[model samples]
Target chain A: MKIDKESIKKIAHLARLEFDENSAEKMSKDMSKILDWVEQLNEVDTSNVEPLTTMSSEVNDMREDKVGTHMSHDEALKNAPKRDSDYFRVPKVLE
Target chain B: MEKFSSFDEIKKSLEKKETDCRAIVEYYLKNIQTKAHLNAFVDVYEQSALEKADQLDEKIAKGKAGKLAGMVVGIKDVLNYQGQEANASSKILKGYISQFTTTAVQRLIDEDAIIIGRLNCDEFGMGSSNENSAHGKVLNALDESRVPGGSSGGSAVAVQANLCTVSLGTDTGGSVRQPAAFTGIIGMKPTYSRVSRWGLIAYASSFDTIGIFSKTVKDNALVMEIMAGHDEMDSTSSRKPVHPYSELLHFDKKVKIAYIQETIDSSALQPEIKENTLSVLEKLKAEGHEVEEVHFPLLKYALPTYYILTTAEASSNLSRFDGVKYGYRTPNAHNLESMYKLTRSEGFSEEVKRRIMLGTFVLSASYYDAYFTKAQKVRRLIKDFSENLLADFDYIIMPTTPTTAFKFGEHSGDPVAMYLEDLFTVQASVSGVPAISLPNGKDKSGMPIGLQILANSFKEAELYAFSNYITQITS
Candidate 1:
């Protein structure tokens, strides 16, 4: 359960985050401590317990799908950092 | 003219034609301007609020006033207000505006409530103290040096300083109640799914709930009655029929109450707070309510279980904030992957990044069963234990927090210590049961100590009645 610097980097990459070497080392220590504390759950016997997904047992309300104006194309892209015409602009993916 | 102390008092004055909505808005706006040091408000809709108040006054003149006439409400940064910035107190969402309003806030507007502004909170509702906010830490109105217990600290302080008539906050794990406890106000987190989550900026999807912070328990009741109902947009919202919670404030029968023997006697509890809570229990018993001690051994697991599940969900929910559509984007990036990584690293604060990393590690392929799955099962155990206890006892009483509000830099060094602040308030949330923290007593230093009361799920009316009864007899 020990989280080394390598594991910390992997987790950061997985979460699309970045940290310098010093911060990554700090994260490793902090994550290790938190994991150790949360390990207390292993002491409980939950062999027959079900994993809870939702608090209430109510079924999702069913409604017929209908298309309506939610936000105009311009409104939807209003907050984009980089935009070209009507679409979001990202770095080229294919050569 | 007498100063209105509560929202109900304001309503009465408006009814008597003594004060119009415009004057009430002006009074609140002036107070907000004066109390700027508290950092309780993020955005104040001064012009819009006055305009809304003028419209409301017109309605009142026409004898068509709604239930929440002239009430000035403040919303946390997380709830969407359609065109207002819902940054969730995080820099990542700096320029993002909500495309639509949340069902809960819309309900308030429908009742003629005037939204004065957005309140500060922990970034994405993560931290216990308001220090995690990208905006800045909210100071406790009573003690400027002490931290306002948060992610709802600003909401609580707004009501505490009378900057607003009432405010709405979200509680995933003690966010509302802890701040309320610190500020000596009333905060209620109703049954999970009791309020719609469609427009709330997601922190932990399953556990996040819209709660109310008010000066009076009756105000919480009235707001909850208006805000609770199923919304087509939020699939998780409960289908339970909403009730007139304010009208059901008469607790005629003696109620059975149980105090967790472990919580009050725990060494972590401040001596003054423990004494105050025990005294309140004794008074409740003397007031003819059957009260006794109960043992809940699983109490220690509640904090760990809450953090594990919530952080995991937060990590997943926050993944949508990549540099694609909205939110902050990094200035320097060569590829799409680097863009996402750099954007997130630059945008998120330290506490947020730490949590996201922890969540990613826990839910990783190598440790999914050990951390994420195990935590889920433990959550089920805690839920069952709470339900069984509530089935026998009408209510469970406990101290809202182990201590009163902590001074700044007290527990900021350690994340675990900050997580421990949620120990008492997370069980009711995990169990999806309604819980309220009332200002029952005060500590030796004159800071407030909250008395937390718990009732079964969808039993908010009973919760309101019991709280009102206690308030009536005790204060």
Candidate 2:
């Protein structure tokens, strides 16, 4: 519940975000305030309650397996920030 | 050409050949140009809109036009419109053009509605005020110093300024209704799964809903009718039959109404807002409707639960934008991990980063059950409590916001204060029920107050009819 510089570093890592010490301090304070506010939920007795992930009453939308049009390779690759031909180019991963 | 208030008037004029579609388009285009200072539109589709108008004029002549023929609409930046940018007011997706149109927007197009433009919004529909938009803050049409209430600020202001006949906005947490309230327009958020979320730039998949903003209830209902129903693209869209909501606006019988006693009497509520709400309730009571005060003790917890779950979903949803697939990429990365870190850090704004980090923290291995899972259970409790209230009462009524249109920089420095803006509006989002913000009246400062009304899930028809009735009597 206590968010500090160390916690911000850990969370920033998990979230793939980066912040310098100053911004991280600010973020830590903001996050602490928010987390503390949300901690009010502890007052409620949720022991017997089932976690509701979605509000939709219906279940899975089943369908017959059939070939249908989808985004072509070129169309899918059209928005790539860094693309080499058909593949999305990124920083060398295996290095 | 004369100014038209509703689509009904426009339809009448179109049929009589007094006002053609081109003329209507020109009228709105003029307004859009005149109100450019408001920063409502991210990109205006002027050429395409004019072409659509000419085509619709031909269809009108042939008497083969669709239901929304000649109706011009502005879509929120968060919803995708094919071949147009849907950046969601964030620099991260700065120039990203949508490959496919959103199901909701496509439905409007299928019914011959002209998409005038993509309006500005909070970055990925995150903020309460429109200040978080990278495009710039949308100025309230009535008062330039005040906010139009956001993440759908531009959407609300578009309709408010008559730049479009109606606009489409996504309400993750009162984005549509709150802005509508702020701008003195009608905003309605239909039940969860009522409208397909196929091409919506996801913030929180479960909480997000495509909503309508219009000057009139009938326009809102007409747009809702066209947009609602199941779509194969969105598995979450309900299979329930869509209603002709515009046609069912006749409400003859009195209904049971429950006003939350705590909310109306809360110290957070502005005096003018509380007075307007009470006056509306009194008017309804005078009209012979059964109105009673009820207690919703779980109202305070709805915001915390909403923030927790939505941030978790946003962190997951936003992970898709890792620089390689689409959107902004960092030029300073030499390694894969640093690429992600620097790209996300530089790409996203501070608020977005905070939410993503908080979401990661809550969903971290150590605190998953305490924050994420427990909040979900609390969410269930809140939803059940809301549905139980609606089971007895025909409608639950409250103020759309704790206050009216607030000044800019008022809550900008404090994220918690800004988050608290969704105080009165998040219950419907949390419960997945249909809720609407009808213009109650204006405050002393002349800013609008909204009377929010919620109904049982899938009861959009009832909600629209009652809203229509209220508008008729009150206006």
Candidate 3:
């Protein structure tokens, strides 16, 4: 629960966010407070409890994979802020 | 009168041509305009709604209309209705027009339900109050200064204000129920996966459920029947046959009701809320129904455990909204990493960013076992408690919130306090049980209080039965 600025910075980076020093300081304090509260779960007797990964008791409700009419290329590109003729444009990923 | 009292009433009036669909749509449009100060809607498609009403009039003339014909249902902005922007009240999703309709919305359209407009909500369904919405806050219809509990605040308010006959809302952790309680309307979050999530923007996939808001339990039941079913596109949608909820509304009342005493007995409850909820319980007991107190000790940890699990899943689910795929993109980035950083920084609200950061931290390899995994274990303990408790009772009852609707900014500075508003409702979400909030009484300020009822998973019929009994008694 003792989060520091460095830990906050790492968490931001892992979440793909870039925070300034001020935000890091604030986040560190806020996160520490939250973690302190969440740590109360440790006192509960969960030794006999099984972990629940999925809520659905019935599984494998898969459908037959068939070709269906999906959104058109233009329609899919309509919402993109940066788009090319056939693809979404983004900052260069490779040199 | 008043454009018909309910959808069934509207359908009959439309069929008999006592009032045309155009008249009904115009009446609701006028109501929406007069109540614009409530900030209940993000967008109102007046022309589209009128056009749909005209089409339904033709269908009625040709004797081809279905149930809910010409009845307008306000949609929460998170749902994708083809050709309308599904912004989810977030600037991040601004101008994002859904190319395809959600199966649930489409089914309503096919049944001749009019899409009146899109209601406002918390950005990405992150906040319990409507104040977090990028479009601005939606005020409670009953009291302008108080919050219409959110993120489904607008949907609940719209129905309360008579802007629409009913509205669809998504409830993750009391999103629908809390707002319904605050606004003095009926809201039901059905069992997880009971309704399709295909068109819903994911909040927490495990707990996100499509719910309905209406003035009456019968109206909510009718809307649920129309919207509930299996959808192939949504992997988690139930393959079970959809039950006829309207028929089930008339089910025999030989059912047991268990008042969840341990959960309600917590010291956090306000005296007024406790007294009002207890009175409602007394009414249920006097109706010749079996009633008892059931204890679930693990219920205490549900709030923290829900936050941990939901935030962890949210961090992963929201990762797909990077600038490269869609949504807002920032200019002047030298590389993909910088672009990702700037886009997310500008697009997401402060609350969203905070949650994503916390989520990533909790789910990180170093802390996964201690936080995320442990929360999942606690989630199981909660679910097991529900399963065992439900074996003895047909439904469980409790106060929907510790206090009635609070004034705006009452808990704004303290996020933890705002989160505790969901303490009583999160248990049902975690357990995947169907639950509802029905307006039971009012506080000293005249703000409404809601009585919550929880039924075992896929037992919506029993939940509705209990709700109908309460509705009859209260009416």
Candidate 4:
């Protein structure tokens, strides 16, 4: 339940978030407290219990395969931070 | 002749042409402006609301007004209202405009409801107190110094203060009912998937249900009747037939109610709330309804299980907010890696980041079974057990919160204690059952005390019937 600073940093990296040493130390402390609280679930016997997926087990209503777009190209790109023409622009992955 | 207050009274007045929709809209706009210090609204669509009100007035003249003809409404910041800033009160979505309307809001519009503004809320619906909102905290209208139970704090305040007729709020684990309790109004979270989640900003998909905050049970019932139906757009939307909840509120059958002994007898609940809840039960029993005390030992585990599952889902749901596609991007980032990290770290608040980290840790390779899977299994146990109890009991009544509205800085220092504010309400979210909070009584300070009524999944009609009966006798 004691989430160390290094572990917090690794998880932050995995979650696409960055924290300085100070915030990371704070996060480590907060997570330890929260996780320690959540550790009480271990006291319950959930053996052989299936993980509940959705709210209901109702069969998903399937639809025919069809091609459609919710938004026009312009509308879709409207909120992008950087966009060129119709595509979102991100930093170049390759040199 | 009496003052028009509730939705039905307003509807009658509008139909009789005693008052026009435009006048109603103007009155609510004035109220919103006057109560601006409450910080309930993130943005007010003044022009659009007036224009819609004018059109509805025309429709009324022609006898073609829609179901919600003269009603004015406010939407929570988390729902997309099309071309409006539905930012979920977070900095990450600061400048984002919704491209499409959520099904729920669209239905409201179709019914001739004028949407006055978008209400504030906890950032991405995370915090128990409204203080987490990036825009600013929403003060409880009852007492500005006290916190309005949140993340639906603004929506609750809007209704409680009469800024709008009814406001839409999303409840993902006590967001709707808790705040409604704090503000002393009727807040109902319909069964999960009862209302479509198509354009709702996701917090926890399974638990994210669009709820309504209104002053009367009938207003909530009517709105639920209008909005609850199958939407092909949202796969999780229930395909079952939507019941006529508003019309069915007069089912006078006696209800067999159960109150959890642990919840009422617990030391955590404040004595005032316990006394009020017990009084309400006694009132129900006095009405010849069967009210029993049920032993619920699993009450303690509901909170931890809720946190684990919701945060795990939220971590995955919120990952889409990275800088590239939309929302806030760091001013300087040379590479994609730094861009993602900087954007997220700068965009999210400390609470959000902590939850994301907790979620990531739980779903991490080493602790997946111990946390995520274990929580999921426990979730099933809670859901099934609660549903079985609901099968035998007509309704489960409990105190909405352990204590009433807390002072501004009371529990903000400890996240766990703040999270425990949901101890009594999360059972409904975890079980996907329909639950409602109504003004039970008040503390000595006159701050409201709310009692919750819960029914089985998709049985909102029965829930409303019981609520209407309770309201009638109590009033």
Task: Point out the higher-scoring one by lDDT: 2 or 3.
Answer: 2
Residues B139-249, model 2: lDDT tens digits: 999999999999999999999999999999999999999999999999999999999999999999999999999988899999999899999898889999999999999
> What tens digits encode model 4's per-residue C-alpha lDDT throughout B297-338?
888899999999899999999999988777899987888888
Chain B TM-scores, listed for every candidate in order, come to 0.99, 0.99, 0.98, 0.99
Indicate the worst ten consecutive residues by lDDT in candidate 4 chain B. Answer: B1-10
Point to the candidate with the largest lDDT.
2
Q: Please identify model 1 stretches exceeding 4 Å from their true place.
A: none
Task: Judging by DockQ, tell me the better candidate of 2 and 3.
Answer: 2
Question: Each predicted complex: what DockQ?
Answer: 0.77, 0.83, 0.76, 0.78
Q: Write the per-residue lDDT of candidate 3 for residues A6-74, one digit (tens) a residue.
A: 887788888888888887777777788888888999989778776789987668776678999888899
Query: Mind sharing the TM-score for model 1?
Result: 0.98
State every prediction's TM-score relative to the real structure.
Answer: 0.98, 0.99, 0.98, 0.98
Winner by lDDT between candidate 3 and candidate 1 = 1
Indicate whether candidate 2 or candidate 3 has the larger TM-score: 2
Off by over 4 Å in 2: none
Task: Report the Cα lDDT for residue B95, model 2.
Answer: 76
Note the residue pairs that clash in candidate 1.
Answer: none
TM-score, candidate 4, is: 0.98
Per-residue lDDT of candidate 1, residues B1-475 (tens digit)? 4666688899888878889999999999889999998999999999999999999999989989889988899999999998888899998999898888989999999999999999999999998889999889999998999998998999999999999989999999999999999999999999998888988999998888999998887888999999999988888788889999998988789889999988988889999888878888888888888999999898999999998888899899999899889989998988888899999999999999988888887888988888899999999989998999999999999999999998998998899999999989999988888899998677777889888999988899999999988788778
Clashes in model 4: which pairs? none
Q: What CA RMSD would candidate 4 show?
A: 1.2
